[model samples]
Target: MQSWLDMLREARAQGRRFARVRVVTLPLNDYSRFGVWCSQFTNGAGEDIRYLERGKAAALALPDHDYWLFDSRKLVRMHFDDRDAFLGGEVIEDAAEIVKHNYWRDAAWHHAIRRDDLATEQHLGRV
Candidate 1:
């Protein structure tokens, strides 16, 4: 975890922005709670983390899976199993796919609430 935080810090130092919009359900599951805990450290390290309720996210009709968009160009789509266990990621370099991912990122980022604000709103103190 320290290494990840260091990487975020280094990226910020290099003037690179790292951000994520996590779509979560009303009653957060164990995994989602864990992610919220981790976000505290990541946000402190300069990564911008936001939260969007699942119902709100549904209106946007974003992808069912998670992805990482690099520089609004390259994309790494994450895959999961039936039980939601991690599988792997597939890198996509197709321009059209990249554009779609960028659009989703922008839309989610625009509607999501910042980590701190969400924590306060949800009464999730330190967890």
Candidate 2:
């Protein structure tokens, strides 16, 4: 068992500031466009990507349905296999679970999202 957020907090405590973090919705291509009318971003999601939407304090709390998290310190690089677990809300405490589960597939234009900084672009929409 691991917590991506906890690992990040600990790293921060040791004077490490996260430069960037990323949350890719992953391609839900299995479903047809009409199959999904619209999907809500995890939390703090501006548009296409969701960052560390909350501060250390708020993240520790996880708030409501926006509890999904990723830890840059713990995990890096996005791949294709990491789709289900990330969106499924499993191991959400540690966003790095994406890496653990190999859920990201590095496609073109992928980026990393961090709480302090965000990749600006409004992304909440229907397929």
Candidate 3:
């Protein structure tokens, strides 16, 4: 955890920006709650983390998968196993796909709440 925070801090110190839009369910599960706890450190390190409730995102027809978009051009779409374990990601640079991902990012960002605000509003705490 310290190492991870160090990396984020270093990246921010070097002028690299970070953003994440997490789709979460109401009454968050243990993992989701833990992620909220972790976000505190990362957010302080300059990561612009936000949360979009699953139902709200579904209403907007947002894609279900998580991804990392870089420079509004390159995207690293994450893949997960049935048990929700990380299964690595596929890098995509196709113009059309990048546009699609950026579209979702824009929509999500427009509606999502910042992590701390969501945590407070939802009364989130360690599970």
TM-score of each: 0.94, 0.23, 0.91
Best by the TM-score measure: 1
User: Which regions of candidate 1 fall more than 4 Å away from where they truly are?
Assistant: none
Candidate 3: list runs displaced more than 4 Å.
125-127
The clash numbers for all candidates, in the given order, read: 0, 18, 0
90 in model 3: Cα distance from truth in Å? Answer: 1.0
Q: What RMSD value applies to candidate 2?
A: 13.9
lDDT for each residue of candidate 2 in 36-91, tens digit (9 for 90 to 100): 22222212222233243224324344222323224422333222343434433333
Candidate order by decreasing TM-score? 1, 3, 2
Candidate 2 lDDT trough over 10 residues, lowest sum: 38-47
Q: Name the better of 1 and 3 by lDDT.
A: 3
Residue runs of model 2 more than 4 Å from their true location after superposition:
21-127
Model 1 pairs in collision: none
lDDT assessment of candidate 3:
0.90
